[model samples]
Target chain A: MQDIYEDILRLAAGKIRQRIRAGDYASHTAGLGKGKLQANIAVMPERYALDFMRFCQRNPKPCPLVGVSDSGNPNMFTLGQDVDIRTDVPSYFLYEHGTFSREIHDITTLWQSDFVAFALGCSFTFEHALMRAGFSLWHIENDKTVPMFRSNIETVAAGPFSGPMVVSMRAINKSRIQEVIAISRKFPLAHGAPVHWGDPSEIGIKNIDTPDWGDASPVTDDQVPVFWACGVTPQVAIEQARLPICITHKPGYMLITDVDDDAEIPVIAHSNS
Target chain B: MQDIYEDILRLAAGKIRQRIRAGDYASHTAGLGKGKLQANIAVMPERYALDFMRFCQRNPKPCPLVGVSDSGNPNMFTLGQDVDIRTDVPSYFLYEHGTFSREIHDITTLWQSDFVAFALGCSFTFEHALMRAGFSLWHIENDKTVPMFRSNIETVAAGPFSGPMVVSMRAINKSRIQEVIAISRKFPLAHGAPVHWGDPSEIGIKNIDTPDWGDASPVTDDQVPVFWACGVTPQVAIEQARLPICITHKPGYMLITDVDDDAEIPVIAHSNS
Candidate 1:
């Protein structure tokens, strides 16, 4: 019998995932799937799924859930009918009880009946929107990875998950700050508006140049360092959780989804009867 | 050690729950706890929780999550530091295998080790916003309940939950409909914007006078029937799922929460480290 993911993935996102799955296009996905949603992937056991789900719900900016695969199911039906969580991302990071273990391109060898896959919104969507509006990203222009930092902002914790939020830093010209805020705020699912913009010290970032992850994009005198919640924030919480085992996408290699970035995703209802 | 649901509830929401907790307030929560958030409650076993949570996530317009009680433990710490899910709401309807088994004011005796409680956003927040803005709601002025109906629109399914959307209707003057929409959009947690307005038939409502639930509020010549997704939509899906047991707040009985109607509600992130 034909599976649900048969036809839809042949386009942009599907083609990208196919390459990643075949180990052909194994680089970062920034600017890959134009106008399509890219997501940060997290896979874990069912027991921790609910708490993690709660954590995501509570911390939506950093963890806007695009789709959650059913326990034991590899197909991310809603995300892309043809996508499989196990092989779609370019690479995966295995975390064993909060400690980094190894990286692999495919989890087909480790698929488990109890695994639940979480696809979280990535800033690439809003970044695309920013560039479209004439805001040139420094890192994108320099061909450097976006700089990320650990902030003092404490996220509301759920069971086994609690920690300071990690944020992605970008230098926006001071005069266009409001316009950037307005543009980014439109995609709440894509980490939304910047959590901290002017002072890194306010969010407890002692040094602006030394990012905990990715390449540092220096803030010039003409610009202020704007920070948006990063997808890596969940990894911090997931680390604190120290689950027996957890899987996440390596920093820039996200799961490209067929879903549109600006679609008015239909919310649903129940009959009073 | 004192529990989390402490001094905070001494305010309006806290006091109201105290009444409902003591069986002092068993009536509908409408017009109560002004400026505070109210939620619809759903309780089921852990085995069914992930799917149910997905159902709510998929059908967010009718099921904007307010708080989800940790599995087994009854404290809805997020909703109220001190609220007990088993006894806080004024009344609950116990559904056994999709059948309305009975009504009860407390579920303490039936609480199980695997029970998970769900608190969903209610339209009252938007209604309160509408009322505060000086736009008189037909039902509020007449002291009638907001009318609800089963629409032909089907909800996106998750696991075992699937069904048509149910919506609550209000008569908005043609001139004020736009204003009402703008006001409600600000409260995304409270069902956000209206799904439909003007002609009821567009959404598959065959009759203008008869509603599936609540009191009928007529739309006059200058008014249009504005329909917002109703909280009852989950119950419709829950009914179809037919789990061994399920519990929900009776139509009008809701969980009054301490959260402000309009707040930034910070979203979260993780550290790459």
Candidate 2:
């Protein structure tokens, strides 16, 4: 078989949408597209559009927005030319009255005329940058989800969307802290920089053995549990709002976007490039 | 006359609320409480709270938030021992339908059950810091409001609150840009750090002489027109929302809180203290 990333990249977004639409691919999308950008998707009613947009606005550390769609449009033209939200992600969680009802591969059957789709910046993009800068990602190496925890930090509230912030924890050797900070600061949209570093108790994380989401990793005496605002925060807020209907990408089955990783990096452009 | 600041601080938050409740003081409160933390105020309807909060979040460089209230509460106890939204500000602007209508000293008569008050970090706090750091402020020396302009930089929008960012312009000698940045960053809540320094047109001010708000200052040949996100952006957003009744501190008049200025400086606290 061809390299998974190359095969995935060659596959048109529409084909990916079709596979997801067909309920054939339900696995998380880690290391699938190599350099391609994957996004966290939030689908909500138009009535919640502004407030939800604000929630992402105030909570950019976790919800750096990549693109916002016009009302009821399934096509996220900005993210990809032929992107259709209803059939994009491999799996999605449907929330009704704030309770998880079931999982589905496609939302085409549930599409609403007043729905708005928001594609948020994800930490996965910066993980590549960190790797390029020589920082090892244990989660990718182990094929496990990044450990995430609910922090004591309160998100600036938006209407119907208020909850504790969710942050992803990474164990980094004490010596590499400055390098990680320097490398991550360059990608502000990808949860920008770590929100909290060192003693987990300081940010309200009680146990390292368990996490709010994803698999937990152990921290050695010389390692610090560095935490960055996670993109999953909006999903938690959506659950709390208890809106009539809400949909979000399944944990790691993100919406692959055409927005190039280099384009999103914040450094000044070189003239020759 | 006795120092106005001493009188204001001597009045407990409850007594000040009583005076504001009685409509006794109807003037700007700048320089009225030398050691206390004063904040720019914005009160909006519950429906617009989330987007407005996001606006502050997205544009923290210009709109550092100090305190946010629960829906329907005029009491900003988090800010002080007994701060009351209905009466503390020396002056308030009442906007209906997103247009300025009238200025008043208190909102006791127009208080709504769903109103939420946000106390923003103000420039005055950082201005005090800048002065202490040995930098000169032209507006303070000449007794005029800081020059403000509507920048071409569009604020990261959340919901119904989307518009150009407004910036307060200050002239600093070329040698002092780094010093200003170091000093100003200590008050992130008070519009920490300059957004742009050097060229006025770079951020999209066409004619630097004519400002969108406040008076203009002459930039000497060696001085740069440094810009910081202004608190006025929220005022502009509230006007844009056009809610039936929105209130904010009248330009220059602020709400004095029991917060000690020395206590709130962003410096890491000394272990012994």
Candidate 3:
């Protein structure tokens, strides 16, 4: 059963990678590549790579690093054998001195010898875990991006990288919050458990209906707003850092890696049994 | 009941701080300030602060940073309001270019304007939790330092900071492994969960009775060796970095903070309840 599941995931990843490499599927990869781990890509010059890596380390909940490529290396060997950082993602956003410059399908021409690539765990992994556990995400069902907000929580700063933590909100049924947390906590790479639940104001979300990014999902009276550290957090910090040049996966468009969503957490050996 | 418990903890902290500040007690702080979180102290010049901070961020299991002080600041407000980094720790180990110079009771005179202090969550917190959960530790019972070894696991390297991960070993009864993991996972700041178990050879341990640091305890046939990310990891990295000057709390002489070992894990609000 597990092998069959993995075979299907490999097939999905192969098809998606081919489409992304051919510049065919350039839209958000929200529901694509089922059961495969999707990553948020950040590429920067080697000079800033160390600081950025530190930034990801300092703010892990917001930027859980899954894999890092050597400086000037486009291959993320740990993430996948054939994973190429330059053209694996569906779309890329270019930043100049932290300012949004333009979007592109490939960075083969723009790739530099000093460039370093980082693959950070995205919320999509945990969202898949939550869905598999039988909890429904309203945003996915409604065909909208998960609502994200700039929370008052401050990320631990590293070098020029520092900013408020950004969080993605989901309206979960009150009864299933524990199950949602249990399943999501297993995937620490994907933001882990929700940072804040119940009252959004506790984490500095002034208005739940109006989010700073993504489509806002309305919360029913039977549900509470639960927030997880968002991958957009690193992007916000990158903009604040204002590096000479930065390349990131455009919002919603992510790098689908060969890692299984369920593989991050290792099985504990049952000594008692 | 809760208020009374906190009051007792505050009182314990005050007494420990007074003794540590007055130079009346200058030794390992183990078994002192019960229920209060103890931290491994790392102090270095501001020039190397960013990289060190990143180092802690990248290698969290070995270096879980709980609080960081501004450069040249002696006060760690986040760790404790009255906590003075210079005098709070029982003993300080001065390192010059990665070489241990000597141990001192206070670093007040050596303190510089470029100095920065970092408080890393120590294993004492989780050990206390485990003890409270009815688990017995062989090292604690025998009044010896926990056995620590250099592992094959290489920590994610940052600028001037990189080394093999060091881990502490504890033998646990076969029946208590799950309970031990469950309790430790709640304290992510204190190395979280075991990195490996069963065989020492799996993580590069050549001899079970010999350790790179600390006293080794034999694992009985009924017990399995459980390894956790050790605080010594950063110390090894610092030695490798060879900064001009670095100050750290001597082994077992930790900085006891006002934060509760159990307080870091916030209780998730059960909406159903």
Model 1: CA > 4 A from native: A1-11, A18-24, A132-134, A173-183, A266-273, B1-11, B132-134, B173-183, B198-202, B266-273
Better of 1 and 3 by TM-score: 1
Share of the reference A-B contacts seen in candidate 2: 0.03
Worst 10 residues of 2 chain A by lDDT: A264-273
Task: State the number of backbone clashes in model 2.
Answer: 7
The candidate scoring highest on lDDT is 1
| Alpha carbon deviation, residue A109, candidate 1 (Å) | 3.1
Model 2: per-residue lDDT, tens digit, A197-270? Answer: 99889989999779989998878888988999898788888889999999888888888765566452221111
Residue pair clashes in candidate 3:
none
Query: What is the C-alpha lDDT profile of model 3 across A1-273, one tens digit per residue?
Result: 444334434457767787678775667777668777888999999777656765665566788877667667786665664678899887999999989999999999999998888888998888877787788888899888889999998876666888899999999999988878777777767888788899989999899999999898999999989999999999999999999999999988898877777662311111010
Ranked candidates (lDDT, high to low): 1, 3, 2
Say which candidate scores most in DockQ.
1
Fold similarity of candidate 1's chain A to the true chain A, as a TM-score: 0.92
For B213-241, candidate 3 gives per-residue lDDT tens digits of: 99989899999999999999999999999
| Model 1, span B101-162: residue lDDT tens | 99999999999999999988898888888888998888888878889999988877778888
Per residue, candidate 1 scores C-alpha lDDT tens digits across A16-57 of 788778876666776667788888999999999998998887
DockQ of candidate 3?
0.14
RMSD of model 2 against the true structure: 6.7
Residue-pair clashes, model 3: 0
